[model samples]
Target: MIKVYKSDKAPEKLAEAGYTCDEVKQAILNDQKDKCYLCERKVTTDYQVEHIVSRTNNKEKVNEWENLFLACNYCNDRKKHYYDDIPLPNQLEFENVISQTINLKTQKADFRISKINPQLAKLKELLDKLFNGKGICRNLMENRFWNDFMSVYRNFLRRVAAYKIDPTEENKQLVIEELSIEQSALGFKYAFLNKDAELWSEFQDYCKWNK
Candidate 1:
């Protein structure tokens, strides 16, 4: 049966730690290795949380923890206000740093997140990808395509310097240069903010593939 966490006295702290009914079910399976709590079956089938109490009888009481239980697909389906289920008390860790973050500058609304507790060493390994990765920098650099496109293009630029690919052309036209998906997506065809990026990107694409 499912339990709803609800009460007039129910603090925001409880609701804050609480996930939706769907999340509670996932937490059980994640924590329990997908075994039926009662029958202890290696249930290969989908399962649901059974609500001991019907939620339609008390919609306001939908998130109360006492009203719910882990249920196999065969046992719990559409019985009622099945939504009030909360994950176990130990399962709901409210103060861990990784659970959620606030993006106060950009959004008027608060954003919440959930995750397995990350290991410090494992988390450190990701710092390079986070701080040094091109995807992270692209936004910070005002939506410019960073490393991937440039690496290929840099090679092309080297080739261009070696030989005059444009024997017929006298002067390079800024209006016409090369671009990649990243630049095109940003709609900076004119390269108004970045003529140099356009030049290097265009020249590199030309040198690499033009021949």
Candidate 2:
């Protein structure tokens, strides 16, 4: 998940009126880069305009642009009217507070708090509820992770093959660059794979060289 700044084009009164305008929706999509605030999943459809503070908890901020966010239906449903002291992405530095690791064997992403801050802990708890809690949310997330992981893995394998067949300096460099890009695209959730010394030695070597 990432912190998003509200755009100037976002309608301030749209949420107060109990409705989201097209302009507001567009601004939200732009701010969030079409990804869900919690899971960082790319939201193409079945996305919802979420209120940072539930409308049930605070009607006054219902239409406030700063209180708005983008979320997936599964998250929205699981989080329904449950707002209380939850940490909000817009209000916090998400990347600094938490880190995620992906387990290739289980195809599950595990989130860990980077520090012992109270607010960060709360955010972790909320994430656990939405992602690690009961029901099929974890299963759904695992499936999505597998799909994304394989997509990138396939590209990585292809690049590796090209470099192996030629063993040229240029091919080697190209493979390293491709791996870096893939690592970044995987973001916090899946980038943990880069830390696997045995599996990602080549990529890790490139990272160290580049650093």
Candidate 3:
């Protein structure tokens, strides 16, 4: 997940037409980069205007711009009326707080706290609940995670194939840089390719150099 910035001009309350207001929808979409705040999944047309703080707990904040977020139907349904005290993505640095590892064979992602901080630990726990809780069926959740993982993994494989055809240092470096960025956002799928251990090692070395 990434930190989404809200626009200053956003409406203070839901429009008279209710949640279907084009202006509010456009604003939320713009702020969220057309991605769900929780799962970081791409959301095009079908998405929910989720409430970061549930209306059941705080009705006053229901239409507040800061409390509104874009969410996929799966996440929205799973998160309905649930409120956790964990820090919101906009309130914390996402990349620094959480790290994810993926099993290439299963395509299941395991989220971990990236640092020793207490707040980050709480964030990790909250993420675990959202991802692995009983709200969604286990098989469905795994499939969703796997689909997102493979979408990026397939692209990584294509890059590797291109590099194999023209074994140039520049081509290899390009793949490394791209994969490093993808690994940061989509977890370790690209970095976990055991079929090309030498190439993966070089990518790791490049990551360390850049860090």
Candidate 4:
């Protein structure tokens, strides 16, 4: 079960400690640009804010900068309601980290759910059973959820190459201005830095935008 902190009224103190939606949204963009921990998706104009600590179980974590990430719409859709079933205010319901290893040559990814709690492990198992090897539900065979993700990123590099643009420095700033990414550049040491990672390709395109 999980314990969520939402109420009819948000306490005054929550308002002051970077609780407002605006303050937190800025923080989220910076983090997304830093590195997409989930799908390793690049922080683009088309990313969705994801709650690291699911809102259903942790209200304090909800909208919290450290609790959020910039995700493309595709990953969000694949991950929708993943933590919704778990009850609020309990630790067991949350899956902190899900590990996946993608095979570049075969284009197949193997995965596992990781967390300190056994309950979280079970949840990870269920996802792994459903998402491992074959990839997401009915459309599992290299469909929109997977291949499109790779295509977008590959095209991103191609477009940059074709236009003769260097994405390293400028890309970060664009994310900051458009999505409010952080001003600091960590020089790509972060996990999200490498665009070639298997998991990165799996979910990077998930952040596409119509605009």
Q: Whose TM-score is higher: candidate 3's or candidate 4's?
A: 3
On residues 1-211, what C-alpha lDDT tens digit does candidate 1 reach at each position? 0111222243343366553445565655554345433222334556665444456676555666554445555334422343233233123322222111212254111212235434322322222222234253435432222333244334434434433445334334322342321111111122222235634454544322101
Tens-place lDDT digits, model 4, residues 1-211 = 0111222333344457644455455554443343343344465655666665556666767645434555555545555555543222222212113344445576554444454655455445434433342334436442554574455444443433433354455654443332222211111111232344643453234322111
Candidate lDDT values, in order: 0.35, 0.62, 0.63, 0.41
| Per-residue alpha-carbon lDDT of candidate 2 for residues 86-174, written as tens digits (9 for 90 to 100) | 67667655644567555567655566887777766766776666545555555666456447645755575576678667878888786
Error of 2 at 157 (Å): 9.3
Candidate 3's residue-wise lDDT over 1-211, tens digit each?
Answer: 5455666666634655555587788878777667777776677776998887777788887777767778888777766765444566577656445665555575355676756777667656656665555545557665666576467666766777788788798888757765443242333433344336877665654433112
Count of backbone collisions within predicted model 4: 14
Off by over 4 Å in 3: 12-20, 115-122, 129-137, 141-145, 157-211
Summed backbone clashes in each candidate are 23, 2, 0, 14
Report the Cα lDDT for residue 125, model 2.
70
Alpha-carbon RMSD to native, per candidate: 21.0, 5.8, 5.5, 10.9
Question: Judged by TM-score, which candidate is best?
Answer: 3
